[model samples]
Each structure stands twice: as C-alpha cells, then as structure tokens.
Target: MASPPPHALIIPYPAQGHVIPLMELAHAMVDRGFIVTFVNSEFNHARVVAAMSPSSSPGNNGVGGLDRIRLVAVPDGMEPGEDRNNLVRLTILMTEFMAPAVEELIHRSGEEDGEEKITCMVTDYNVGTWAVDVARRTGIRSAAVWPASAAVMATLLSFNKLIEDDIIDAEHGSAMGKETFKLSPEMPEMQSAHLAWNCVGDHDQQATLFKYLVKGVLAVDQCEFFICNSFHAAEPGAFSLFPKLLPIGPLLTGERGGDKAVGHLWQPEDAECISWLDAQPEPGSVVYVAFGSFTMFDRRQFQELALGLELCGRPFLWVVRPDIGYGKVHDYPDGFLDRVVGESGGTGRGKLVSWAPQQRVLAHPSVGCFVSHCGWNSTMEGVRNGVPFLAWPYFADQFVNQVYISDVWKVGLKAVKDEEAGVITKEHIADRVEVLMGDAGIRERVEELKKAAHESIQDGGSSHGNFDKFVEAMKQA
Candidate 1:
C-alpha cells in the first residue's frame, strides 16, 4: 500500500510582508509533492483571495497554478471591525488567542473539505511557539520559519548573549551606551542601541516584543528545524554565528521561466508604471521607490517624501500605497503631482501607483535603484534583481538591514535624516538618488550578490541543498 501524501499546514504572522514569502514557500512544497494547507488571518485570507490571478475560489484557494496547495483562514481573535494595524492589540490578541484557534483547526482537519490528516506544521516565530506545542500534542512534526534575514534572527537569538557581553541592559533590553558591537567577530558590526526589539516602538512595545523573543528561544529546541528566508552566501557571518539557522531562500515568486503571477495582499493596480519603465531608454535610469505596507508617515514627512521624488529629476516609478499614514486618501503638496506624475500615472517624468508588482518592477531593465524601507522582503527582491539601493530605514530590523546593505554589502547608501527636521528632505533625497544611481562600484557589487542569489536557489546551490535536506527529513517525521 502507498503512504498518505504529506499534508503540511503553513501559517504566517498576519502581515503582508509575512504572507507573500510564506506563500512562495507553499508553492515550492506543492512542487515537491506535499499537500500544503496555507493559513492566513480572516482579513488576510480575503485580501489574498482577491489578489490572486485567475480569481481564487473561497471553496478552493490554491494559487500560482499549483493544485496541491490550499488556502485557509482562522479568526485572529479580533472583532470584525477592529483595527489590526495596532501592533499592541495584535500582539496581545495573537498571543492569547491564535494558539487556540489553530488548535481547533487541527482538531477538525480530518473531517472536512477533502482535508487530510496534518502530518507537519510550519509557522512563523512571531506567531508564537504555542502553535508548535499544539502540533507536538497532535503528534505532527513542526518547523519554525524566520521571515527576516538570518542576521535579524541572529540578533533575536542573541539576546542573552548581548546581556552576557554587557552590550544591553538585562532588564529593559536597552543598549548600555556602547556605540557599536558585534555578535561574533564574523558577524557584521551593529550599533548597540539598534537591537532588533529596541527600534520597534516605545519602551512598552519593545518589552512586549522582547518577551516574545525570549519565549521563542526557549521553545525552539522542540522544533525539528529553524529555517530562514535568507541566502547563506549573503550572510555567511550571521550563519556561522548561529549555525542552527538554515538558509533556504531568495524565493522569487516571479520565477524566470514564466510561472503564473503569485498572490499579493494588495493587488497591483498600475500597469502603466511598467510601460513607463519600458519607455526609459537607458539601461538603468529609473528610480523605483516603494516602502512596504506597514510604513506610515506624518503629513510633514509624507510631503517631504513626495517633494523629494519630484526633486530627484530622474525618471522614477514610485509606489505610493494609499495608507502611508494621513488616512487612505492623502494629498501631496500643491502642484506636486501636476509637476511630476501627470495624468494616467504618466506624461511626466514620474509615475505613482497605489501598489506595484514589486518583483516585476525590480526586474525591469530601466529600474536602476531602489529607495526602500529595508523590509527583508524588499531587501531580498533588490538583491535578487541586482538593484543598488538608497536605504531609508523606518524602524525595527530595517536599520540593521541598512547596515548590511550599505556598510557590509557596500551596494547601497543610507539616507540621512535631518537632526532638526527628523526626516530626509527633498534635497537630500535627490542627492542620494543621484549618488546611488551613479556609483559603478555599487552596481557591480550588487550584481555579484544577485548572481549568488540565483545560484543559491538553483540545483546543488547552498539553499537548494538545505531545502532538500529539510524536505527529506520532514518526510521521515
């Protein structure tokens, strides 16, 4: 008799950044003959279903031309009208609520909608390890997926080490006034104050995040594998410093060989931007600026960013997501849109979209530089396309990712915020864009990383081998 096909239930923390990459991982699993049940928050499930190509069905939500994958959602312990953008509310609810919801789903798995017995589980660390414990109770194998760069996870896993080394205060997790330090000699140098949890929010929020980290570290020993969406070739030092982390990523869902487009939380609303990009004659002349979904700006900073793109002069494709603070409907400074991005998101030197097909945008030949928030997904996309960056880090791991891109990788330059104004002004934005696009060396270095990224995902590369080993080991369990 043949064995039952492995059914893996995959869940990500409830965020667009988290969902997209994990969806890519599920796609890969289906290719490897696993029956993947991808889980999302009720809100995210609707958004992802709406964004999928060929139109996703509520009854069957497989995406990207894969038949073995299914999409499911569980309540995130929130009211239907509650604001999920509130991090504190989200953290409290998910911590107190998500485990039970997921447990219920597992308990009912064999009873409905052609569902098979869940043989394994994969979940993000931010969603808490309670789900992992539940998997163990159900006698299913489990793994934790770190959605950030391996180095970011290194910083998280090194909290006690930081205390032991006297780099941060044990009580508050604040930096002990040291200017800079390294986790190990091999790891990249990081500012003591820029510890992963420190830069997230205020002291209370930081403490909440810190609590999660401590719990995750303690519970990680039970999981069979702790993998990350990072490439070993990109962060050898981080990998060496934390050998437990296996790198199996740079998962570009926009595969080179014409795979169907992947689902996005926000649908790509502007096709003209790509046409605008193609019209640029130079090999790499267009500036592509996009901050991922969670970045918010006050009215002043929002105006500054708009005017900065206007001042940058070079042709640019900017994805201005509708909810970048100041409400869903925001107005730029007077005459700003008229002067740069004219009617139909074109006719002028710049074009703006509510959302973009990011991987496709980065892969365009005319796109020379990425003005980014340094979200790990953005970081991976930029590296995969060999686009040098003008880093505008907002918060959290973004600052550390900036250090890696500008200081360690030498393929980008960080935008300097005005000490008095506390934002990167239009003049500074123009200056950085010019410098980043003109640097031949930065361009060359990123091309090297881009090559490594593609190689790592191909047959026999480090990521390929690591993934193969993981899948084989999971099959046994």
Candidate 2:
C-alpha cells in the first residue's frame, strides 16, 4: 500500500511581515506533495480572506487554486475594539492565549477525513515556540523557521554571549554604553542601537522584548532544525555562527507565479501606480518608496519625507499606508503632491497610493531605487529586484538590515537621521536620495545581488539543495 502524504501545520507570528513568507513556504510544501494547514490570527485571517476575496484581481479566488493548502485561524485573545497594535498584548496572546486553540487544532487535524496524519509542524521562530511544545507532546516532528535574514538571526542568537561579555545587560535591557559590536570576527559590525529589541519602547516594554528574545533563543535551540528564510550566499559569516541553520530562501516570491491567493494581509489597492510606472521616461529611472506595513511617522517626519521626495525632481511611486503618520491621517503639506507632479512640467510624474503591489513594483524596469524601512521582507524584495536603497530605518531589525545594505552590501546609502530630534529631516532625505541615485557602483552591485538571489533558488543552487535536504529530514522524522 502507498504511504500517506505528509501533513504539516504551519504558523507565523501575527504580523503581515511574518505571515507572507510562511504562506510562501506552505505553497512550496504543497508543490512537494504535502498537505498544509496554514494558521493565522482571527483578525489577520479575516484580512487575508478579504484581500483574496472574489472581485479582487486576476487569479485571486480566496484560496480556491491550491486544493492541498488549507488556511486555519485561532483566536489571538484580542478583545473587540481593543488596539491590536499593542506589542505587549500581542506577546501575551502568542505565548498564552493562542496555545490551547493551536493544540486543539492539531488534535482535530488527525481526525479530519481525507487528510493525512499530522506528521510534521513548521512555525516561525519567534512566534511558534508554543506550537513546537505541542508538537513535542504529540510526538510530531517540528522545525522553526527563522523569518528574518540569517544575519539578523545570528545577532539575536548571540544575545546570550553578549550578556556574558557585559556588552549588553539582557536583564535590565541596557547596552553598557557601547555603540558597536561584532557577532564574530568575520561578521559585519553592528550598532548597539540597531539591535532589533533594544530600546524599542519604554523601559518596561524594552525589558519585555528582551525576555522574549531570551525565550526565543531557547525555543529555537530545542527545535529539530532551524530553517532560515535566507540564502547562504548572502551572509556566509553569519551562517557560520549557527551551523545547524538551513538557509533556503530569498523566498520573496512563490512558484505560483504572481498568484494573489498566496496570503497578502493587505490587498493591493490603487493599481494605477503600475501604469504610471510604465509611462516613466526609461528603465531604471523612477524612485520607489515604501516603508513596509508598520513604520509610523510623526507629522514633521511625514512632511519631511513628502517634501524631500518632491525636491528630488524624479519620477517616483510612493506607498503611504493610511495608518501611517501616527494614524492621524495628516494632510500633505499644502499641495506638496501637486508641486511634485507640477515640477516635472505638467506630466504628473509622481504617484502615491495607500498600498502597492510591492513585488510587482520592484520588478518593474522603470523602478531605479527603493527608499525603505529595511524590514527584512522589503530588504529581500529590493535585493531580489536589484534596486539600490535609500535606507530610512525606523526601529527593530530594520536598523540592522540597513547596516547590511549600506555598510556591508554597499548597495544602499543610509538616510541621515537626526537621532537627537528623532527624525530624518527634509534636507537629509533629499541629500541621501541624490547621493544614492548618483552612485553607478551601487546600482551595479545591486544588479549583481539580484542575479545572485535568482541564481540561489534555481535548480542545484544552494537554497534548492538546502530545501531538498530539509524535506528529506522531515520525511525521515
């Protein structure tokens, strides 16, 4: 008799950045003949369903295409009318509230008719530890997916060592007045301020994040294998620090080939931006700016970014999510948008939207540069498309990603932030955009990295080999 097809339960942290990649992984698994159950928070699950609902776009039919892939949701313990953006609340939900529901779901998977037995589980490194514990209890195989770059993961993994060396006080969330450190001799230099969890919020918040990191390290250590959403070619030094890590990514896009059903939390609105991009002067002539799903800006910073984009005198596409600018919906500074369009002598060269089809936008030939927040997903997209960056990192792993892009990869230039004022002014934004746009060497390097990214996922490539090995490991388990 033939064996049952492998069944895997996949979960991500309840964030857009985390959900997208895990969805891509599920797609790949389905292609490899695994039955997949993709889990999301109740709120985000609705958003994703809405985003993929019929009457949206081509090839988007609310998960109708992939018969083997199933999406499931569990309550995140968020009360009605509560602010879902609260980090403390989210952490509590992941560690405490969501555990029972997930475990119960696992139990039900076994009883569902026509489904294979739950043989394996895969989850995001930061958010899926609770699921890992459940998998262990049920005698199922499990792996932790590190959803960030290998470099970022390596830095987080070194937190314990940094504490022992007095480089950082993990208990008190203090960094011993030191501004810089390296994870290893071969690793790129990192700013203490750039540590993803360092000084993220108030003292209590910082301490909470610190404890989360400590717990994450321990949870990851317990996993059967650590799967990273990065390619070994990108960060060799960082990969060396974690020998057990399986680097099988640059999973920026999926094999489904532009299918909108691959779980976008936010639907792509205002797609006219694409036609506007096509009408630009030439290939690699327009600047593209997006600060990812979360980064918030104050009024001054918002004004600065708008005015600065106008001052650059370039054809540009900018995504300004509605919730940005402290969620107040601040008006643009008195015809700033008009001035940007009017400056190019009546052709309306600049376009702004609430959200963009990012992968498609970056892949556009007219897009020359990316002004980004350096969220790992955005970072990977920029690299995948060979678009050099004007880095404007706000918080979290963004600052570290900016270091890798600007200082290490040499394909991006950091936007000067007035750290004292807690903003990057108009002057700094304009200056950095001009500097980054003018660099032929950076553009060339970006093209090389883009080629490398594509190559890594091709047949016999490093990522391909690693992914094959990972699948075999899961089968053996």
Candidate 3:
C-alpha cells in the first residue's frame, strides 16, 4: 500500500513580524505529526540560514534537526539589484511577485513524490487569495492564518461599510485627511485616525492595498479553516465577528526552553542583549522597548523617546534599528547618550542595540514592562510573558492592537498623539512610563490581565482548545 502524504506547505508574508507567528504555528503542526515545508523568499531564506547558530541548525530532517520542518525558498520577482527606497513600489512588488512563486512551489511539491503531494497549505491571511487559487488548481486544502489580533481583523472588515457610506474613499484625495471617522457599532472605541493610513495614500497605492485586503477577507470564506493569533477571552467582541475564526495564540509557548525553532524569515538575532539583561538588578526590574521592524521615527522624535527613557529613571533595553529614520545610521542629539549614562551614575543601566533576541528578552525575568509599537506579534509576546505595556501605535493594525491593549484588556496605557505638532514630548512619555511602572494600583491591574492572558493560552484554555480544533479540522479537510 502507498504511504500517506508526507508534507504540509506553510507560506507566510515576507515581513519579520508576520513570519515569526506563522513559524510558531508550523512548529505546533510538526509536534502533532506532520512533515512541514516552510517556504520563504530567496532573500529571506539566506537571512534565516545566516541567523542560525551551529546548534540552531534545522536538524537532520533538513538545517538544525527540527526533525519534521524543512525550509524552502522561492523567487519574489524583484530585479537582482533593485533600489528599495520607494515603499510604494516595494509593496506592489510583494503582492505581484508572490503569486507565481507560490504556484510554482505547489507544482514542485507535487513532483517530489508521486503520492506525497502537497496535502494542505497554511498561509498568511494577506496571501489568502493566492492560496485559494493554488488550492483550487492543485486540489489541496488551504487555510488562512490571520497573524493579527481578532479585533484588528474585525476593524479591517468594517472598512467596506466606511467606503459604502462615502465616509472613506477607495482612492486617496484631499478627502483622505479631512477628518477622523469611527469604524463600526461593534468597535465604537476605534477612531478613523486609527485605521491604516496606507488606505489613504496615493490613489493607486490605496486601491492596491484595499484590493489586497478585500480579496484576503473574501478568501477567508473559502478557506478550510481560519486561524487567528489571538485568545478568545482577549477580544470577545471581535472573536464573535467571524464565523470560522479560530484563536490559537500567545504563540510563543515553550520560549524559556532551549529548543531551537526556526523563525519565518531570520536575521542574526543579537544574543548580547540576553547577557545585558542578566546583569540587571532583579527580575521584573527593567523596561523592554522595541518598535517593530518597519517603524521609522524622525530625529527629533527619537531624541524625545531617548530623553523620556532617561527622565523615567528606569533601567531599560532599547532596540533602535539603523533604518529607524531616513538615514543609514541612527544619530542621537548631542550629549543624549552622555546624559543617560550620567543619570545611571555611569553604570549604564540603559543598553541600546540595533536588534535583540526579542523572544528571549521578553521572557527574561528582568523585564518588568514593555514600551512597544502595539504590533500583534509584540502584543502576544508581552501578554505571554505576563508583562504590561506602554502602547505607542505607529501604523497598520498597530492602532487597533492598542485599543485591545489599553481599552479592552486594560493591561496597557496609550501614549498621547499630538494632532498639531505630530509628535509626543519627552515629558508626556516620562509621565506615562512612571504611571505604568510606579503606581501600585496600575501594576495590580496589569498583573490581573497578565494572569488572564496566561490562562487563556494554557491547556484547556480557550486558545489551546481552539488550536486543537483547528488541527483536527485540517486533518478532516
């Protein structure tokens, strides 16, 4: 008798944030007895290999001995040496390039083993429509993975009505920045300013992103299962919005263990941050700060944030990437580093690096609070680590994630956005950080939510149960 199919193809969106959660989910599938093939763009595949330590190899089964998980690369259709200065062009290329690459992977997987065809596809929600096309063409099951909180997805779905009512336009014009609007009756707490600004960029760009989003949402209707990186209890209102949505989150389980799992698109994670964290005074005594990969801050704003950290008088680990501004290297204002060092009495309680091992840093006992951009991956990591948040939303679903963190879960406090100046002052930042860290009542409230977040992802918890159901459904499909 012939053997059963031996592989599953997992395709995630190319960004670091999107890839990490999908990688965790793929690991879960591997643990449950499946051959996993994680596909990445060629550029990303090289990065992942470069990032891995000898011990971190995928295993005999492929790079560290993940045993069942294999990494594969597909072309992303960019020219060999294209300029990446234009965000609009990059976005367009990502959408257009991926479809053919994914289709080619399906064809190649089918040819590898006659009986071991591509049984199913696990893909990011943004890639949903393409996955659907591949599934239809190849006769395989496809599932959509929403690597975002349920609340954010619900908010995106509401844009259709905003467009219908002429409150928002499918194309950008003078009307794009006219006034803020509310999302839906269900999400009355969300304001129009919180919706993705990409929706209001140049007309063609706006239409392209909206088109991709709409197609992804509609493709969910055809998926065998819809997976969300969220816990049901974390966003009850939004959880109720989707018929097929499955919550399987706080995805960074077993983080403290030494097991090496490959992330979606990998870069050489700076492990030096771990040693710096260890040298801190005590557990839960330091603040961890990071804006997700794509967030860029102007020079003045970056200085204010640095000054705010100093003014708060807290030990901190801040990750400031080179591309944080419109320059190659981040240059702080004069004497900023000197001021912070002097405030710490020359012991350098503050450590700033371009990148860090985020999971390990979050899980570190010394981390007491997180000042984050409210990206979904970071939010889940914070919740899982039982840390409270100081939310500074930048773009995309970040604003919606902030709503869940501050308004819904009550585990976070939002940074005030300045309408006229378009910048937050150091004083405002210092005040909020102090309130979140020093107030006993606020600390207690944050801890309560942290406990609840932990419970939601534990065995027999809502997220855990949903994960099992999702896997079972995939088996049946």
The stretch of ten residues in a row with the least summed lDDT in candidate 3 is: 253-262
Top lDDT hit: 1
Q: Rate the local accuracy (lDDT) of all candidates.
A: 0.82, 0.79, 0.72
Compute each candidate's TM-score over C-alphas.
0.95, 0.93, 0.88
Model 1: runs farther than 4 Å from truth?
Answer: 64-67, 112-114, 253-263, 324-330
Q: Report the Cα lDDT for residue 154, model 1.
A: 86
Model 1 pairs in collision: none
Of models 2 and 3, which has the larger lDDT? Answer: 2
TM-score of 1: 0.95
Candidate 2 per-residue C-alpha lDDT over 141-239 given as tens digits, one digit per residue, 9 for 90 to 100: 889998888887887778878887777886855678677888898799888766777737766777787787677778777778888888877888988
Which ranking of candidates, highest lDDT first? Answer: 1, 2, 3
Clash-forming residue pairs, model 3:
57-63, 57-64, 58-63, 58-64, 58-65, 58-66, 59-63, 59-64, 59-65
- Candidate 3 regions exceeding 4 Å error are 1-6, 57-67, 81-91, 94-96, 113-115, 164-166, 170-188, 197-203, 253-261, 264-266, 324-330, 339-347, 418-422
Check candidate 2 and list the clashing pairs.
none
TM-score pick, better of 1 and 2: 1
Model 3, span 311-331: residue lDDT tens:
888888887775525323336
